[model samples]
Structures are given as C-alpha cells and as structure tokens.
Target: MAEIIEDFLVKKDQGYYCAYGDFYIDPLYPVQQAVVSHAHGDHASPGHQAIYCTEATAAFMQIRYAKQALSSYQVKDFEQKFHLNGVDILFYPAGHILGSAQILMIYQGVRYLYTGDYKLQEDNTCEPIKIVEADVLITETTFADPNVKHPDPKEEILKLAVASNIMLGCYSLGKAQRITALLNQYLPEKEILVHHSMLAFHRIYDKFNEVPMKYELYNRKSMKGDEKNKVYLIPPLTFNSYRRAKNVLRVFASGWARLQASNDLSLYLSDHVDWEDILTFVKQVKPRAIWTLHGDGRQLHAHLSDDLIIRDIFTQTYRPDFC
Candidate 1:
C-alpha cells in the first residue's frame, strides 16, 4: 500500500503547519515560507520570506503591502497543481473576495483541504466557490450557528433607496468593493460616492477588470439636498468618527447583525458561508472528516456530527503512522 497523510496535524502559534510540504498555511505572523489563503488582513500579512498564492491574491497583496516589506512571492493560477517539498498543493477559487482560495494539499494518496473564508452565495464582484473533494475538510465557520442565514444581498442593497441620500458603513476592502459593485448592478441610476481611502482599491479592482463601476472620490461639494437616489460608501471606522450632517440615513452591512446590535438599519450582506450554506457545502464535499476554523465552531461541531467525524485542529499534534 502507498503512504498516506496522517490523521493528525500540527498547530503552531503562526498557523497550521504542514509537515509534508514543509510550509505554513496562512501564518498569523511573519514566516520564512507561507501559503496564503487570501489577501484579507486576518488571513494574510507582510514579511514572509517567500509566499505562495493565486495570481489575483498576489495582486491584492501588492496593493495592500509595500514592495519593501514583502520579501518574495510565487504566484499560482487557480486549479494549478504545484509541488513543494515533494507534496502536492492546489488552489481553488473560494469566492469570499476577489482572490480568495480553498487550498488543497495531497501527500501520498491522502488529501486535505482548507476553506479560507469562503461563501457559496453569488456575488457580482469576484470568483464563485469551487468545490474540492478531500479526505479531510477544514472550513471557516464564521456563521455556523443554526439561526444565522444571510438574506439576498440585492434585497439588502435595495434598502438604500428608502433614504434620499444614504451613508453606508463598510470595511474599505472586501465589503466596500462588494457593496459598490452591488449598487452599480442593482441600482445603476443612483450616484455612488466613495471615501478617498477606498479609491486606491477601486483602481486595483479596475485594473483587474473586476467590479467595474463609476464612483467619485468623496467631496462635500457633491452633497445636494435634491437627494433622490444618492449613496455614499465610506470606511466604517472613518465614518463613525466623522462629523456629518444629520439629514442622510446611516446603514451597516455585516453578518454579525444576528449576534450584535448596531445603530441604524443593519444589512445582512456577508461574504462568509452562513449556517444553511455551511451545511450544504458539507454535503457537497462529502469529506470523511471535518475541522473548523475562523470562528468559535462549537455550534458547527454540535450540529455536523451526524455527517462526518468532527476533529479539533487546534488541539491536535503531528502524527506520522496513522492515515
């Protein structure tokens, strides 16, 4: 019989360590060689000696990190299998954002996959989720609770029409670009204004030809009382601190609305797999074993036991003999 990947894996302070490939997956801090899952701040950071990821993710990294801070990068196209330390690694589209990926690792005859902040729902801005069947499936359980389910994003986007001039609170990166594209697609007649900080990423998105939309760098002169179908997109962190007029309605876009309360209307527009979608993905992949990442996955562990063996990666140590 051929050799197989072990039933156990290692957990270090940096991230999940892959012994067969001699690499780390989405290291929390700087490392010698890291396999990045995406360009999102929590999953990706600068100062790796060498980085391996999809081409689109590499482009996003260039936009986020200055060249001087990033040491080296190896760009891989989606579905391209590459060899590192005699181990096979593959990248599959993860649909969380523009360049997100679900990493698949194969050692000998056994396989494992890591879903890095993924969503199965449709988005107008980026690639859709690509499913990969593996012996072990590790997922980001951001919204794993049974009660949490995201409404259609276009329905949420349509809510902007209620206020003549609306102010949207979104993160400058993924959430901001997603909403911007949604607004353009669903409500093209509305005028879209964006914060200066988000303008740079818009150019990056434009360069990639992803989410092409018209937007103006925010200016007070653009403020008009006529306010029929006008929208302002700003970083939530910045918008909360600014001194703005009371006339415009404020709205927040996030999945955490189910758990937390926010001022004004909360639009459940998330890029992560919700509870229902998470279950659907598990059934689609049909993995022999499952592990949770991203958020506290107690609910998922409790609920998904009937489908597959739920393993806890954080508490596991490396083992070689058993597969």
Candidate 2:
C-alpha cells in the first residue's frame, strides 16, 4: 500500500484520494466529501453526497443537477485553504469556464497541483488562468501534440467573421459563450442565432450574470425563412447530422480542429491551451513530476526534457486498486 502511494496513489489511509483539477474522488473515502472543479459535466459528477466548488459552479450545478436534493454540496471560494485528512487543499481559477478551478494540495512538505481542464488564453467570459508553483503537477494534455497550435483568438475570430456569413456548430456551453462574447465585442450589432441547447446554456450564463452580450435565441422552427446574416451556434452532434441551409457554411470549434478532418473555413477556436502554451506553463510551474491525463499524453511527454518526469495516467479506464 505504501509503495502504491508512491507509485500511483496520492495518499492511502481509509481509502484512495486522487486529485484531478478541482475535484477529488476516493472510492474508499466517503463520497460525501468530493471536491468539484466546476460545473462542467465531465468534471462535476451528479448525485455525489456532498461537493465543494466555487459559487458560480454551485449555481450552475443547481441548474444542471436540479433533480438531486439541495444542500448536498458546499461551495468553496477561490484561494481559500480547506483542510481534509491532514492535508491542506486550495482552489484556484483555471480559466476554462466561469467557475473552473485547479486544485492544489499540500501534504506535509510536498505540494501537488491538479489542473482539471484549463486554458491559458484570455477569455472574456471567465477569469484568466493563474500560475502557481508546486512540487508535483497534474495537467491536461488535450492539445499537447506538437502539431497542434492555434491562432490568436482575436485574429481567428476576425478570419471566421470574414470567411462566412453564417457561423455554424460549437459546444453550447463554455465554448459557445466564449465565441459569442468574441462576436459581441467585434460585431456588436449583428444578431446571433443559437440552437435550443445553446440557448439553454446562454440562459444559465445570464442567470449567473456572466453574459457579455444582449442577443436573441432561436430554435430551428424560428430560424425557418430567417435569412438574416447571423452566427448560428449548434452542438457538434446536431451540426454533423443536420443539413445546413443553402449558402450556410459550417466550422467546428474545438481543440481537435487542427486535424485534417477538422480544417473548415470558419475557424478552429479552442478553449484549451495549445502545445506551446502547455510547454510554457510547465516551465513556469517547474513541477518535480508531471502527470498528464485526458488526451494524447504520450505525445506531450516526448516533447519535454528528461529532467521533468512525465507520467501519463488514463483516467477513463484507470483503476487504482489494480496497481
């Protein structure tokens, strides 16, 4: 068990506590004590006994997991240290979403930082990412491959606007908000058209007082015969299946858009950091060991110097007990 703690586990006592970004989950540890990094579906699990997250995260969680009983979670503010199991833990903004956070834990003299899903680029919808030093850093390598580099957001948005009259397809949640905000800043008078899913998320953003624009939401029914020059925000699944109206152009916004399959005319606007940004962050933090998760970690590992030990952990299929 002790060896496992050194090799795979963070700490071993009652059960297992693994830190990823702002959330901590331990199968052996009480489920009631999990810490959520944000309200994103991939990061925040529904029906947990109790959760700790930022206030904005809590509000979004309420809207998302409304069926679950209220008061089952606790909201933790930024930079506040909370102690658990003799370890000091703190949450810092990750700049991926409105309430996203990176979890930093200090046990005895060792410090470990878990970056859930983060973006170093400036986004108008959320706070900017911050740099913190730690002994060990767990980060995401979503866009870590050497070939993946993104254009500046402002430049990309301008190109996207000039390339097509109709902007189609984007994640309705954080990504959509970001793209919309960019459009609002650049094309203030243009009316933006959004699908139902995007509308729902926009409503949530409005509820939280983070909406940067005054725009109208439109469904498929409402959009019929509406030929106004506007940006249409739709989920990827919907965009791929639905036939676009004649003269409508489609562009996919994601970190993976750099691939040959994803190069469309609109733009590849990503919410995640590019390869250069990842390396820059690693150098800034200078962690003793780097743990990479969630997408192409091996590619990232190969680029870094040998001095920084890179460990790729596959959380999707990872089970700590077997180790």
Best by TM-score: 1
lDDT of each: 0.79, 0.70
Query: On a 0 to 100 scale, what is the lDDT of residue 315 in model 2?
Result: 38
* Count of residue pairs whose backbone atoms collide, per candidate: 0, 1
Which stretches of model 1 miss by more than 4 angstroms? 1-9, 68-71, 224-228, 243-245, 258-260, 315-323
Report the lDDT tens digits of candidate 2 across residue range 1-323.
Answer: 01112333343332225543223442333354677777777666666677777888877778777875678777788899987667688889898988889888876577878788889888878878888998778887888888888878888777655434465678777888888888888877556878776776776666665454666777654445555556777787887776545556667776564422643564778878888999898988878788776677887777664677777653344444422
- TM-score of candidate 1 against the unseen true structure: 0.91
Best by lDDT: 1
Model 2 stretches with alpha carbons more than 4 Å out: 1-16, 19-30, 162-167, 207-211, 220-222, 258-264, 314-323
TM-score of each: 0.91, 0.84
Q: List the residue pairs that clash in candidate 1.
A: none
